[model samples]
Target: MQLLEYISFLLLSSVKFFFFYPVFITKEDYNFLEAMTFGLTAGFIGSSTFIFFGDVMYQFFHRLALKKAITHPPKEKKQRSIKHRRLIVKLRDDYGLWGIAFLAPILITIPLACILATRFYHNKGKILGHFMIAIAFWSALIYIFKSSLIHLIS
Candidate 1:
């Protein structure tokens, strides 16, 4: 029963991590080791997947959009324009790995991350490394906090 629970938790965590970390997991689950592993893997996989498949995903979407447009063109004008390019650049410059791995999940979805990576022309391997590092940092923080809380409570 306990094993099942743990496995369920891990699977849930992984799914949630794919979309958003520090999200699906509850406070009760925040043991030091669990927190560390969750945060690290979540951040790494989430961002790395985004970065690696970013361009490919973008192309796929683009093709889809084109097909859709051909079939049924939208009447409304596009909302997002080139104006935000500078802001994106600034974010890329300032936050870099942290921005993509940590903030991206909060601000945008995995698909969006892939889109942004494509737009920014980020290198696949480098982005993966950055994501992994960011995950490690986030996981470490979670672990430390959980450990402290456990100590206090026990």
Candidate 2:
């Protein structure tokens, strides 16, 4: 049961909600080091999954969508989509990968950040490194301030 919980913690941490899990682990009588290690490991696994497989998965899904497409797209929807795309491009240009890295663990999920980094930066090592750095930073911050976060949550 304990082993399963640890695994669950790792899996949950991989996607998001990692920040809140450390307190749970500590309450389970695990040490801070254990929680930090699991968080770091999960962050790496999550980021790596998207960094390597993101494009392939996206292409596969794209093909699937194309197969079931509507013959004629709505003109108003197309115009709205064009505006959204321009906004996204502008934000991407302004913030770049570092912004994603900084916000990944806290605001953005690891997979999304990794996908964005892989899409725009095209540097696997750099993407992974930045993500790990962000994870490490957040892990340390959260662990140090767990009491405060828990209080705030309550």
- lDDT of candidate 2 over 22-70, digit per residue (tens): 6565576445687678678888878888889989987888787776566
lDDT of 1 at 73: 91
- Which candidate wins on lDDT? 2
Candidate 2 residue pairs in backbone clash: none
Model 1 C-alpha lDDT per residue in residues 15-112, reported as the tens digit of each score: 35533345434434665566676666655555655566666777888899999999999888655755576677888898765586565444555446
Off by over 4 Å in 1: 1-30, 80-90, 145-154
Q: Write out the backbone clash pairs for model 1.
A: none
Every model's Cα RMSD, please?
Answer: 4.0, 3.2
Residue 3 CA displacement from its true place in model 2, Å: 1.4
Evaluated at residue 13, the lDDT of candidate 1 is: 44
Q: Give the poorly placed runs of model 2, Cα more than 4 Å off.
A: 18-23, 70-87, 148-154
lDDT of 1 at 32: 57
